[model samples]
Target: MKVITKILLCFFFTTIFFSVHIKAIEEEQSIIIEVEGDPHKHRQYIEDYHPLIEVVQVYDTIFTGIALKGKASNLERMGSLHFVKKSYPVRTYQTNINRSVPFLTETDDIDTEQMKFTGKGVKVGVIDTGVDYSHPDLSANYKGGYDLVDLDDDPMETLPEQGEPTLHGTHVSGIIAASGNMKGIAPEADLYGYRALGPGGRGTSIQVIAAIEKAVKDGMDVINMSLGNTVNGPDWPTSIAVNHAVDRGVSIVIANGNSGPANWTVGSPATSPKAVSVGASTPPMKIPFLEDSFEDKRIELAPLAGSKPWDLEKEYPLIDGGLGEEELPNARGKVVIMERGIVPFSEKARKAAEAGANALIIYNNEEGILQGSLDDSQGPIDIPVAAVGKKDGQWLMDHVTEGEYWIDTTYQNIQDKIADFSSRGPVTTNWNIKPEIVAPGAAIVSTVPGGYRELQGTSMASPHVAGGLALVKQAHPDWKPEQLKGALLTTALPLKNGKGLYNPIDQGMGRMQPQAAIDTETIIYNPMLAFGKIDKLKDSQTVDVKIENVSKETKTYHFELPQNTHGLSWQLPKSFTLEPGDKKNVSIQLSVISNMMDKGLHQGWITLKAKDTSYQLPYLFINREADYPKAMGLEFALKTFSKEEYEYRIYLPEEAKSVTIDLYDPHSLVFQKTLVTLEDTEAGVIEGTLKKRNITENGEFIANVEVKTTEDKTYNYQTVLSIE
Candidate 1:
């Protein structure tokens, strides 16, 4: 009888110990709590919770919230508090810069030197990985700023000793207002750096929001954010902060993102309605293409950064290099073709170069063409590297297997073409057309930490517009933020793809034309018409467009009929005249016959004739429920305060009946196991935690997510997940 009692006591003690331990682990989660009243007043209340939640920071300017660390169960309980409005999981953001000035200025037609619009007396803030204000070109224009990471006034770029050093913000600032030997678009604009992202160019959404509020408090006329995350929702926290900043009279510019060449890839901050999101376009350059020996096939090559340029004129034998993660088959004096996965692009290039390969081509594992860069940390790769689409790579691989295949290079003098890396979008939920405009982003030479360096991305494209807005602001100090944004969009030059002009989602109004924007007298607000999703067979939508005559003379406007489509019809306003300084709002209606038209996204341009020039306003609408990705922005990582637990977050476009994430070996592509499975997941961000004991292994994995929507539709998405 004593032995039985001892056994029961031992069992009870073990159960109690584990319950307390689990509770301790669960209390380490961090989230941002938005409250109904002032966040400062509610801090004590949050800290006094049963589990003892810690208030990290209180925000009152741009966002009324408090960042706190506590148990998820307590977080839900706090949500029930009358003062608590909502809560958001802290999401991380990463740095996402330069350009030829003459290409955008149209110097031949309008001499900027003669015009003397140098953006003097305008304050422009760059919120990125901080800046090297000591650079010779940027020193004179460098104004004081703050560092959110360190909570100080010294907003310098991350140093080597501090962590991973960064030059991204310096490059972006130079593009806006470099005052030395290399002149930027607006050389005289006052430049300030907000160090939101710290070491390794990484920062959380809270830091970003804090930086925006700081910039606004400093009374910055314009702000540029070259950093973004993979969340596509328009209502994300950072995006909402952007809208609020714009409402406060600050002109905000954001990089559309680099996850592109595919539709619906534009991420947060860029998805903000009031922000001017910029995309990438190439300046005048020689683009390389590979042709087969028989001249039967040709494929475009997007050269990777930090590698030798593709200048091979002679035909070279092509050999498949698998994933380039392992040993290569005799590739001496030949071109190596590798698939993109497992290892970094720089690692693959290093292996190929060691194998005496003349060149390297890494193809995408997914549908679209790959736009990649070699890691600078791995050192320079001697051989030239380029990327191609999966289909083209597979074709080359098939030909290589059949027999020996040789390829020769040809060059196309391409300019104003959309860079494949520039993210595209008709933002989810709101279905708004993003990337309000494109700018020169490819091979832009600007200021780095030490000297000048050439970098490329939508990051470089954003500063060009920011600088242009500065010039506009200097030229018309009376104009509001909306007018400045509208001026750029209405005057942009439309860009063309292989089929025709690139869609609004791809290129927006088109590449930025600063000279035209400065000289234009008419500005059209809400130029890109997004009719959203049409579910009914006979659906009609009306959009309000505001037109302002900024020119000195009276101007008359009339809309030309759009191309005749079977199921689409339009109602345009009658010809109307607006005198100088006059503004009017006009309603344009679109009627859709869904049964007669094809289902999916439909977009085109509507012409509006104003005086001698004709303006093309982009229009977009979906016939029925469009087939956008069901899941995206999947992220998994170990908890910051608890190593024994792992957390994950994913964005779902619609309510899903079930969501499953399957893990696969990066190299072998074999199924490992189901990493996560959930039922009845709602739309928006779904976040959860898993015990470390549940995982079989910890390493890098290729996560293939299958989401079944409540409507019985299934969609798949692929991403890389790493755990330690």
Candidate 2:
């Protein structure tokens, strides 16, 4: 009797231990639970016992899952219950948004009224801050959506009194389906709103994951998430969620990041490998050119912030304010030209304004034309202010001594170029060439809450691709998410900057061409090749790319290798044929001889000339002198604690080599003392303290963070930290 009783007690203790363990895990946080059993059975069980488990969304077909908000302990308990498979805490997500007329041309003028595919029946999900569905441009196609932020059915982007409003979501929605005034890439596509991010343009990861699962469940053809956070690895929760969504026939597009001019800044979701990560590019300047007739030169004119336009018909007397010279006699009712250097542009404009000048022009000391912005608080000038390029301004000073010159402001057709602020890549982990493509992101005009806005960033670029995807989906209704992605990538146009051929690390295939993608009958299966880091220049390194002929007619493609092979070279077949509806894998060999190899990143494209048009595939070979340091440029908003003290966030992907935080006066162009210097610190993120030095006056101050990695690569990121 005693032996039997001991056995029963032992069994009972084991059961209680596991139950307690599972409860502990579930009690930690709210998690989404995926079950392998009948949806009806789980629904009944949830209804019967777990009253706190509020099922936000449910999927029965594509995958059986339930998005619930409950205690982590309870969630773990549910996992052990009948039918439950897994449960994990929800991951956070943030908002990302952007023009783009030339991008429309690149998309084959999809912005035009007569485009064949308008994404009429397709459902595109904008899973971000709730969208302003009431906006005239989006009202027609706003089918309806869910608001995960407020746990409501109406997914509306409501505005707050201060800070970034629902402008991001509204802007992203406009880029995909806005019509009437501000045209979108696919104005006729049906838009499904998902309010994951809240008013401040941020939301927890779980909210975003739930939204993605819900969008897939709702059968969204394409989903655009112009939001992300810096993630170290590809196995991040958001990345996994995106790949899972893609597996279930939903196309996902994400913004690579705005942390640009760097090597590996591609953030999570974009690093998913399945996602179409987009980067920003500058379209033709929207500003007009001013003719310097004396020098026979046409100089581009970028208006100063808070400046007015001048009447072009009248001519004004031009005066030269010597270097660092703003005050001059006979300057009233005349245009003053000041050379850049020795003083801030605002100060120059202020001095010129004080001297009673009619207008002000600051010539650049550097290469390109400078975009000047005068501080409004510095006092109003009541006259127009503009910037001129270095070369033209120098010529103006040398040629026109004294004369009443009439400046002609005429428009010019300039080619699109990569935006300097747009993030670059060689993605940190796999070096898999981020920013699969570039789009017009600078000065992009789109819808806001009450009116329209012209915003810039990778945030703006992602929507262009998202809108393009809707068009591609409408054209090929049966194409899978991967197929749609491959079509857009393979058919893109190769981009080159002022510096010459842009590396594959800078642009994946190139800027996207949606019109060509829709009309093309053939496509490449592989997105791009990332020959990560080859220590030695072997005889040859080869990768296989599968080509598919989706058309009814057999197609022949002739291979063309890059002419200027610096160190890398490819051996391609003279020609290849793909029968209708057939797929063939071609082995392209990339060889690098010992003498030709370089230390830094080596990148280029392999072009395939088809009968009608050509397709290009990008490849990267990174042979760094030293192992590249892992670093992430943080995105943070400054919060003021007091007049002297302010708090800024330091969110790092990995420990920094050293970080220096400093404050600068924009009006005076004075660099204050370095607030803090951290060396060999190992913290993922922190609310760092910054104290202002000699801040006698109260206004806005610019806080800059300079991060130097172990590899000597420096990342300079800044934000406006003000004392209100």
Candidate with top TM-score is 1
* Model 2 lDDT on a 0 to 1 scale: 0.69
Off by over 4 Å in 2: 1-94, 97-114, 161-164, 231-233, 283-285, 288-412, 498-500, 537-540, 564-569, 593-596, 624-629, 633-724
- Candidate 1, after superposition: displacement of residue 12 in Å? 44
Model 1 worst lDDT window (10 residues): 12-21
lDDT, candidate 1, equals 0.83
The whole-model lDDT of each prediction reads 0.83, 0.69
The estimated TM-scores of all candidates read: 0.82, 0.68
lDDT of 2 by residue, 1-724 (tens): 1012222222110000000112334343334456787877787778788887776666664346666666754554565476765333223356642236444644345464336877788899998888888888889989988876656688877565523466688888898888778678888899999988875777765567778877887789999998886554465667778888898889999988766666665678788888998987766665557675665778766666446554344566677886645357777878788888888776777777778888777788866436445555555657777777788788778755755454555665555577655667766546678888887776677887777765667888898899889999988899998899989988877788777668776777788778878876888878487766665656567778888998899889888867866666678866878889998888887777645666767777767777867776788766644233333333222221123444444555446688876666644536755556788756354345445553344565555667776667776655444443
Model 2 TM-score on a 0 to 1 scale: 0.68
lDDT of 1 by residue, 230-343 (tens): 778887879999999999999999999988877888989899999999999999888889987474788999888666888898889999899987787689999999999998
Each prediction's RMSD to truth? 8.8, 13.4
Candidate 2 at 600: error in angstroms?
1.3
